[model samples]
Structures are given as C-alpha cells and as structure tokens.
Target: MSAARIFAVMVKEFTQLTRDRLTYALILVMPIVQLLLFGYAINNDPHHLPTAVLIQDDSAFARSTLGAIAHTDYFDIVETARTPAELTQAMARGRVQFTITIPGDFTRRVVRGDRAQILVEADASDPSATGAAVAALAGLPQEALKRDLLGAVAPARAAAPPFEVVVHRRYNPEAIAAYNIVPGLLGVILSMTLVMMTALGVTREYERGTMESLLATPVKPIEVMIGKLAPYVLVGLIQTVVILALARVLFDVPMAGGWGVLSVGTMLFIVGSLALGFLLSTVARTQLQAMQMSVFYILPSILLSGFMFPFRGMPDWAQWIGTIIPVTHFLRVVRGALLKGLGFADLWQSLGALSLFVVVVVSLAMARYRTTLD
Candidate 1:
C-alpha cells in the first residue's frame, strides 16, 4: 500500500502498454468503432419489407384489400401469384418475405354477408420482420371490414359481424423463442470459441518463442497458417454438430433444410471467424492482450449482430456496422437455413459476404504474420 510502490507499478504497467503497439491501436480504434456501430446501425423497427400477394379471387374486394396493404407504406408488393403452388414456391425460394392469400370466394363471401378468410403467411425466422408483417396484415383486414360494416349497417345501434383472422406463421409458426434463439446461439458460441482460441494460438506461440523455432523449419508461413487453422476448423465443426444436436434434441428446433448446406455455411463462418482471430493474434504480443482484443471485437459483434436485439429495429448506421461483422451474416445464413428451410439461392448474399470476410481477414492476417515473421 506504499505510495512509491503504487507509483512504480503504475509506471511499469504504462510502459508495458506503450510497448505493445497492437494494444495501443486497439485502445484507440475500439471506442470509435463501437460508438459508430451502436449509434447508427441498431434498429428495432423496420419498414417497407418486400411482400407478395397471391390473389386467387382477383375481385373488387380482393383488389381493395391488396390496395390497402400496398398503400400502408409498410410493405412493397414485389410480385403477384395466381396460384397457391406458385406462391409457395416464391416463399420457399425466399423471393418474398411476406405473402398474402385471398381465397377464391372472398368477394362472394363478403357480398353474401358472410365472413371472408384471408391467409397471411410470414417468414417468422426473423421475428422482427415477421412481427411487423403480421401486425400490418392483422390491421389491414380489420380496417377494411370496419369500413364495409359502416356502409352496410343501419345508423341506429349497428353491430359488427364476427370475422376470422387466419395467420399462418410459417417456419416457427408457434413463434417459438427457442427456434429463433437456438440457431443464433450456434453462431455466438462459435464466434466466441473460434476467435478466442485462434487469437491465443498464434500469440501464445510467439510469446513462448515456439513461433521462431517453427519458422526455422522448412514450413512456409502459409503452411504454418493452415496447420494452425486445421485443428480449430475441426473444433468449429464439432461445435456446430453439438449445437445442432442440442437444438434438435433439447429445444426441438427444426432443421428443415439439407444438412450439407448448414455444414458448408458453418465451415465458412468458422474459417472467417478464425481468420479474424489470427489477424488479431498477428498484432498482439501477449496472450492476455490477444484475449482482450478478441473480447473487444466480440462485444460489438454480439450487440450489433442481431443476436440479442432485432436487427430490423436497429438504425441504418448500426445495421451497417453489424453488416461488417462476419457473425451478422453467419447468423442470417444459419437461422435462414435451419428455420426457414432456405437454400443457397435464397441466401447467396449472406454466403457471398461471409466469403468476402474470409478472404479479406485471412489476407490481412497473413500479411501481418509475414511482417512479424521477417
């Protein structure tokens, strides 16, 4: 508790921190990055989501309902389908996020003073988007019904007839929280494990002088990188399998898509996350520093990646920042595949973004490692 001793310790700590260029850069860069990401990208309310209408009735009443939805500014009609099969195909292909179906007897039912049925199907894999779509659909028919009721009813003590709202919440139709959360848990688990593991892997070798000894051998940097990465890649796969099994067995989360696509997407996500960790490791001189840097990167990823909060609710700036993190795209791919039964054609954008992340992060890590090796 001596003042002199405390001052000396403080000085030593400052000297160590100053000598570590990576720690210094992280301290400087992390705040700005996190501020921008938190302030701009996170949004809970989303508008103008792409929607489709399948009008089998195609009558005045059907057109009125469609016009009401379209004019609300909540949805943009991207396509129209005349048949139910065609509408199903569009939903399966992820061409439309929300679908509206007006039964063939809609106009006749309304005219006959009977309740008409409208089927609203939403991709509930993304809860925020699904909720917004459902809310819009729920209100649309009610408003139309109210307007029609007012016109048909007597001015004195008019009573509204009973109507039914049929909401088909597709893919987690029950709005199971586990179905939404479990798939994302896989991404979060892998992000934490892979990034921290790989971040420490290279830095620990350098700190212990093993990296130099390895470099002295015939192994090239690329080979060393691959060798270092191979084991963790397997670890990532193991984690994926474990999580998938738990999700299915314990949580009853359905795997509607092919296992092959999930496997490939998981591997790609692991590679990208591992590369990002390796990049951090190349810059970090100590294992402790590497761990801190990994945390710094991971914190923002968890917050902004639509893991805990809804991505659609986030502001544009926050959403943009979330997009930069590999976890964001990975979550989309995993959840979309696992819950929505979506295929590569539907998730090409996320897949492509993950690929880009892998390339850029791995290249940066290699470049930095090369400089460190030389």
Candidate 2:
C-alpha cells in the first residue's frame, strides 16, 4: 500500500522488460507494423486492376475506347489476347481482373447505328475489389467514343449510345461476400492455429525441462523438426476439412476446381505454416514469448496476405512485401482452385512459392535449434 513499495515494484518490472529483448522489441515493433499496414498497405478502393483486351478490331474507334477506359485509372490493359481461350486462361490463372472483347465489326456496326457490344468480363471472386472498378464502367459508354464518333458517326453518339458495355461478372456474379471470405478464412485460421500451436508446443518442452531429453537423443536436427511438426500437419488437415465442409454446407461456397489441386495446396500451406512456427520457437525463450512472436507473424499474414483486404489495391511496395508472406500465395491457391477451377498449370507459381517458403523456414529452424543441453 506504500508509495515507496509501489515505485520499487514498477522499477523491477521495467528492469525485467528490458532484459527480455524479444518482448521489449515486440512492444515497440507491433504498433509500427499495425500503423504502416493500416495507413499504407490496406486500401479498399484499388485502381489500375490488370485487364486484358481481345481487340479484334484494329480501328481508331476501338483504341479510343480503350484509352478512355484507361483514363479512369480503374483498368490497366496489360495483355492483348488473340482468342477467347487466351482470355479465359488469363482469368483462370488469376493473371487479369478484367477482360474486354471488342468484336471485329464493332466500328462498322457503331457507324451503321446497329447493335455493337463491348464484352467486359470481370473476375468477381473478390467482389469488393471489383465493385468500384465495375461502377466506373457505367460512364465509359457515353464517354468512350466521343472523339471517334465524330464526322459520319456524330449522329450515333446522339442516339441511345455508340456501343453497349455488357458487364459480365464471372464467378460469384452475385457479389456475395461469403464466397470470398469463407475460402480466405481457411488460410487465416491455418496460419493462426498451426503457427501458434507449433511454437507453443516446442516452447513448452523447454519450460517443462523435457527439451534436455530431446537433446539427449541422437536424432538429426531436421529429423527432430519434422518429427515435432508431423502431428500438427494432421491437425491442420482436419481443420481444413471441417472448415471447407462448413463452407460448402452452410455458406454454399462453390468448389469449382478439382480436389487434387486443393489437397496439394492445403498440404503445402499447412507444412509451411508449421515450419514457420518452428522457426518462431527457436527464437523465443518462453511460451509467452513464442505466443507473442506468433501474433506478430499472424498480423501481417491476415492483413498483407489479402485475407481481409484487396491484394491489388495495396501500393506496389506493400504488394512486394505481401508476396514474401506465404499466406498471400496460399490464399490465391485456395480461392483459385475453389472459385475459378484453376488447374496445376494455372497455379504452378503459387505452389512453387509455398514450397520455397517451407524450405526456407525449415532450414532456418534447423540452424536455430540447439544441439546440446547447454
């Protein structure tokens, strides 16, 4: 109850905090990470989404329309697809958010006052990302051909409109939030649970003095790491099954892709997450420190991984950082396989990224793991 006793206790706590360098660093670093992510990385209104154009008409009018759409800062026509198959592959692979098909006779039809339609196909898997961009398309019909519809085509502009912009929202056409969220939740949940559980389980061994027995065993470091993580892999798979089942039954989330692709992706992500957790266990001295480290890792995984925010909406630098996190690639795999029916050919890069993450994390964990009781 005394003032002197209270002051002494506070001084002791400050000393203890300073001694625990990892905890002290987390205290300062966590807030900065949160601030940077929210302030710079997280953007609801993403612009310049990658778009592909199947320009069958090599006319001045078609180019003018594209120029007008690009001027809005909503779509960036990155690819020129020669055929419908090319455009379909791009969308399936998560390469482009939108595809515009300008028919060969579009300019001819527009000048004749006949029906001319510009097909705008959007990958609406994550509807929030597509909503603003789709909304921007409304005015393109009125403004797109303003300059091109001059001279002989002047009367066409004054009519109903020069050409029709037929917006087809592909995959989750209804803009259902649950369709996007449920699949992403699988990654977020696995990242949180697998990482935290593995870190804590290993750290617990040290606290209970069981780590000495583990050190006494002549098992190789890689062997020990794999042995410890093997059980958690099963746990992760079980969780994935449960979540996906609920997603199908309750949320009606479509599983458009093959089970084989999803299975490979799920296994890769689970092992990668457990490997990261093992890495955290090596750095943290106590169970509490391990838990704190897991949270630090999970925060960025949830935010930068596109689990909660629009991935393409993030600035270039932020997107670069997001690419380094495993969950970012895994989310693509899950969402792609389930929603778009993307095959191995379409998702090879993401699968490769997950494999690289597992290798890097497991190597780091092996190097950090202590060989002796000392």
- Best-fitting candidate, measured by TM-score? 2
For all predicted structures, in order, the TM-scores are 0.83, 0.96
The digit string of per-residue lDDT tens for model 2 on 46-66 reads: 999999999999899899999
Error of 1 at 195 (Å): 1.7
Per-model root-mean-square deviation over C-alphas:
3.4, 1.5
In model 2, the worst 10-residue window by lDDT is: 144-153
Give the local distance difference test score of model 2. Answer: 0.91
- For candidate 1, write residues 1-374 as lDDT tens digits: 79999999999999998988877887898889877767565555666667778888877667767777777766778988877888887777566777888888886766655776788788777666667656766566556655544455423113233234588888878788789889999999999999999999888998898888887788777787888899999999898889999999999999888565677788889998988888999888799898988899888778888887777566666768788888888888888888877788778888889999999998898888862465
lDDT, candidate 1, at 292: 88
